[model samples]
Target chain A: MDERQLKRLLTEIAHEEIPDDMNVWHEIRQQVETANSRTTRRGFRLVRTGLLAALFVLATAVAYAVYQGLIGSDPGLDAVNQANLVTTIEETQELGGDYDWAVTLHYAYADANRITVGYTVTGAAPARDQLRPFTNTLLRDSTGRQYTWLPVGGGGGGGGGGSSDPDALVPFEDNIGASFDASIIDDAPESLDLTLTIQLAYATEDARQEFGPDVMLPAGDVTFEFTVPFIAGHRYDGPQTASASAIDMTLQDVVVAPSLTRLDLCFAAPPSDNGKPWAAFADVTVDGNVVVEDFQLLSPIVPVADSDCQQYVMPLSLVEYVESGEWTLTIAALRAPDTESPDTVIQRMRDEAGINITPLEDGGYMFSEPLPEDMTAASAALADILSEEQQTLEGPWVFQWRFE
Target chain B: MASLVERYQVHAARVAYLITQDRSQAEDVVQAAFLRAYRSIDGFDPRRPFQPWFMRIVVNQALQTVQRDRRELSLDGDRQAGDPSFMLHDPGPTLESIAEQTELKQQVRQALKALAPEERAAVVMRYYLDFTEREIAAALERPAGTVKWRLHEARKQLRTLLGETEAEEG
Candidate 1:
């Protein structure tokens, strides 16, 4: 067939396959409205905070005490509270049915970049090989923009079994408490009127086992609407420059929020005669306490839009409230990716570490078996090589800022 | 925004469906792409046409979803069960012309199934979306030369899969 005929045929197939009635604007609108509401409420809160602070202090304290249970055992939420950045969300809903299920929205913390919400699900565990409780959450602001929950570790959802069996049912806990973190893409408002919708459905283990279509329980959605005032943070936009190992680096922006700290650093690209990719790494400390953990030096290196220098945004999650004191970001080293190919890396791991690594089709490597306890160090070294941290230029190029 | 969705949803969904070969997933990819476009509208330059930027998001999201589904399938160790080509839309109406059209669609679907997702995307953009090679490159974030190569390879594969020789250019 000619190009024209193929085009006509493809168009016809598409038109026939996708009906004209298919529209997803309703879903889009739901998410958009939630996001917009947060912006509006944040503006409103900023305008009213000065006038209402004195009158609301006592009432807010009492509410805080009542809602303190919701933030149970989450280090991040506890840090937000310690930083005085948390807003209590004392709302609960009952799923009124055969199963006495209840959901509570405990508390929320929002900074300029991220929002974290703690919640709890109190219900009976599902009977083995029967129905299982499935909880889906949708978070939105007053205006209707939805925020996707950040996956903790590699997977999303609060709790699930790690069994490899297809028929293995995840044993549900009576009181399942979890926290959801979502990064705000747009500029976060000073105050947000957030609405979180939690829908509960009981899914069967398998359709083939049940010999029928999957069933959805009659339990409806439980929604909690609350206002969370963002904890004030500091932003340093002045150019802070330091040079080490003949490489000049500048700290363009540093935003220290209750939720997280973000650093924007610009540096001159190291000479690459061999066409190898290089990246920068930093060690951040607040009052002599190291704040950055598991700093992945490679991946996500973006070039500054209007400048020759490359920029990287490093987000650090503080486990504890950062006290008002000295803060330092030391550009410790510049590292380049390993010059060897994937095959070479795999071969080296097998030869030196005696670890069999399989390269997946998606450009990732997997261990053939779980590493022995003694092999963890070797595995870490292998990871560094795979991540391309071969050559290194060491420097303690430091940039300091005071938060008071 | 509604008007924009109305104008682009069918084509965007069609491209996503053609690439992913799953109706429900295509719908989801289109919705997510529209939401992303809406959220990032402030970053968009007004002087440029919106279609390419929006289409780029749809294509990228579709590609990511396909990759993620593949990863999940690999982890689950049941690769054959969730193959998406089997989940193409229902057959068309029973009239003579409609039956012929349905047969043609089946042939096209089978032919498309032979190409990789990236090749399918390139072909859809080039033929159905009428995107130029440069435009396709910009949308896919690949070099123009790479886009040309993909299109050439995809057309050759499709010709072989569909069992038809190229006719003279109009």
Candidate 2:
């Protein structure tokens, strides 16, 4: 008989006989009844004893909490981060004081090799440096402006905190477009020592006092450590096996559809890393125009100090979706001190952002098509949730590109 | 005032039957399940019906055991629960031959494992113990329509697993 018939027969549930082995339940029942009988015989005495015992326990617990709270037991994530205190505070409960913030890290989201740290500041100006793995440092001001500490000829080999050349810290884009999908997260251990410093404080009156990132604390540079949860796909030990060969940007397969709007972008990371593992992030574009860019990704999901870090492979984002296209993802090459050469970055970006999104009449994206007519009931029930979301967007779009 | 174990005794075998797919595993699962049931009986609602609630706990524990064992099988809703369908259809050599005797039954057991977790559960509750679909849905915290769909898919998959034709699966 087929599995269906077989399962039909097996779904029949039946009860069990009392085991001849051990009757733990039987003994437990007897013990409970004995306890109950004892209570009935000396009811008042038993109640008084129980109440006294409970009070003693509650008093002990409250005393312990009071001691801890006085010594600043567990500071909030914000306070610990701002204080930058490496050691636990015994006198003050605020972990991160007004200047430096430190925290007990629990997880990381980067691949094992590159530590990714995220931090915000109270004031806009401060001096910052990563302690180990590399001593990379930078400076920022009250307006959230970032400066790259360029060591004349320093960005060599081990990178970041490695070089100690004549320094000329130049103004760099303080905020890079970093979009990550933590929709599917898992536990992967890693961390970054986040240090945010706001300098140039004496220049403005408000800068002297009102400068926390997003109006939180006050004005000034603050350094702290915040932990991030890991994303499963990015974790790797040493290197990646080139599961898919790297694509040459010059010969990228371009699909041209004219009427498409709304594009869904994703990155396919190389399974592992070799330092040569091509997990690079970049800005995406169509026809020489920038639709999306700055994909900074940290692998393995989270990063903690004194532990390994995750690398940012290809950071993918929806480049600007129109209804259709004969679109060319103009691979822009970057000439930077902290990124891969532009051409290679573009090629890596294209491979990960597989251009196989379904262009539809509603301009919204669907990961699947109606199951081929061959499989069993292909019922509309399967289409339930997807069709529900599709009904929201108004108007229709067309696609000139024959998606073959 | 009655002990918890005594109250759920009648449904024990039925609960074990659906979960382990084997009388031995089912028996063990039920006994352990009851011990756990007793330890946490304070949480029991005095107002609700006990059978479905007990079955949910028993079935959940059984399914977890199966998962731990990595048993792959199917969930079929059509097979008549009480009938010994295997013995009637596949009569082979020696009744002494494990293959001829219990093989078909075991295959039936394993086939049941292939169904999606919920669908298999549905089939077990509905056909095996003859609980209605509504009761199965309530036990699972799922809607009746979703339950029907899961059952339909499970049955379809099982038909393929069991080598049944269109009429049997449909």
Candidate 3:
């Protein structure tokens, strides 16, 4: 194709049919008005200090109630609390003014490697279907070094027990709790002063689905300042080697922290015909109990820098930690990503499992019938194909470490 | 200010979409770029064309967003494998002319995805936005020679990826 043709094609690609009702200017005006109102109300705080104190006390009580509710719900935080690593913060700060939002910092856990903070928001909630409240967080150290904070796991909304149906529209509640995680300071300082700034905002259903930025509520940004003493973890550095199926593997290190366990491993596998990268998955056990229930879902295997190695960081439950005991990490299997195209995979499913999948207009497939509760036959067939497509070298490459 | 947003919002969003490959993320990038431009408008020279100055912010924002997403994905690891129930299926045939155009666009998109983000930016600025090499260099804050080299390499890669032979230079 000539440059003219390329230009035409690209120009066509660039042609986006923007909706007529997308009034970005209106949103911007709303933000500007909110900012101006906040500025004007900044001076009225001194006169309301006594009232603010009363609210603070009430908020503290509410926060304790919320904390109690969260204890048995979140296993990770429960484990951290059981390990005596959680620092409780019961103070409440009001977003104040027209936006009657109150935020309470419930608890925090920090180590040299990671940090987790939990908080609850209480106020007038937006409509469930139209709008949702979201907390945009920024974490910075005393030196003003900002770290990228992300949601620890999927469920961000809490407090209301909604329906199990995916199609159900759950109502928004006045109180909700959320937890955020970030990789904290690497160098272990005795203690570090940190500030977490959370901006409470509302997002329309469209915006949320589009991943658009949230519209800042009229309330000002809430800041929580706390000092977190760095908790250190036990690290075992080794060149431990094990071999199976003519492949040699090495365990570089293992780090056992209050929040999670990390394993650094290196190995070389024979080149596959499809040329996809190989990944090593392992089963971890602490005192004869399996630490990870599903190796494929929760464990994140990250590639080590400048080496043919992968580092797996598995989150620990309360039962996985022992004050003084042995931890065994057994490499169970090696697998590669599916190299087959989606159409091919679907065809194979139809031919082998007798599952007819219909293509939807949105490029997704729908099963001809509701899937059976027991998928043993379908799963077994897929597993057979998967084993055939990817070479799996099975080995009980075990590395044991005892920590006190 | 409203006029400026109205005039440039579609173009900016489209360019961002080409770079980020996500409609919502592209819109977010455009919104942020416009906000940034509004805050920094005092620094912009009145004599200069606003399109290039504004587009520079859009390109940079898109690139930064892409980079940040890559970092997050690396940390998060690959998402769960596609469930058979929701797997993507092949698009069937359509009207001949429309199908040809759709196929061509899909091929171009795949080729663009294969290129580096920076390379994609250079191509979008040069061919899609019709920015001259000097204009692109000024917008990107790079040397003219570097801009030319980037455009050259990007074009060569696109050509090879698209399975097209040498074409006349613009």
lDDT of each: 0.57, 0.32, 0.56
**Model 2's CAPRI class?**
incorrect
- lDDT, candidate 2, A1-404, per-residue tens: 43344434454323122232212334434543343233211111111111222223433332111011011011111222233422231121122333232222222222221122222111111212211111122433233334322101101011111112223221111111111222222343332233322221112224324552212222232233333322122211212111122322222121111111112222233333212222222344444565544322212222223332222222221212433333333222211111223333223323543212122221212111111221111212212222222212111111112122
The ten-residue window of minimal lDDT in model 1 chain B covers B161-170
Give the range where candidate 3 chain A is weakest over 10 consecutive residues by summed lDDT.
Answer: A40-49
Calculate the i-RMS of every candidate, to one decimal place.
16.1, 24.5, 20.1
Q: Each model's DockQ?
A: 0.13, 0.06, 0.07
CAPRI category for model 3: incorrect
* Model 3 stretches with alpha carbons more than 4 Å out: A1-75, A81-85, A96-102, A122-129, A143-154, A159-192, A205-220, A243-249, A267-279, A285-294, A297-310, A318-327, A340-397, B1-170
Candidate that scores best on TM-score? 3
Q: In model 2, what is the error at residue A291, expressed in angstroms?
A: 67
lDDT of 3 by residue, A1-404 (tens): 55677777777776633332233555543443343233211111111112222223423332122112111123444467767878888879988543356788877677644576777665543333343455555678897666643212212223232232445443332233333233334566777688988777655556656775423233456999998777776777787898887888899887666665656677888875556455455666778977553243122222235676765554444234655477777777765544434576578878887764443332223333223223334444444554455456677677887664
For every candidate, C-alpha RMSD to the true structure in Å: 19.1, 27.2, 22.2
Q: Highest DockQ: which candidate?
A: 1
Q: Tell me the TM-score of each prediction against the true structure.
A: 0.40, 0.26, 0.43
lDDT of 1 by residue, A174-222 (tens): 2222333333435656688888777776645464266544344545678
Angstrom error of the Cα, residue A129, model 2: value is: 82
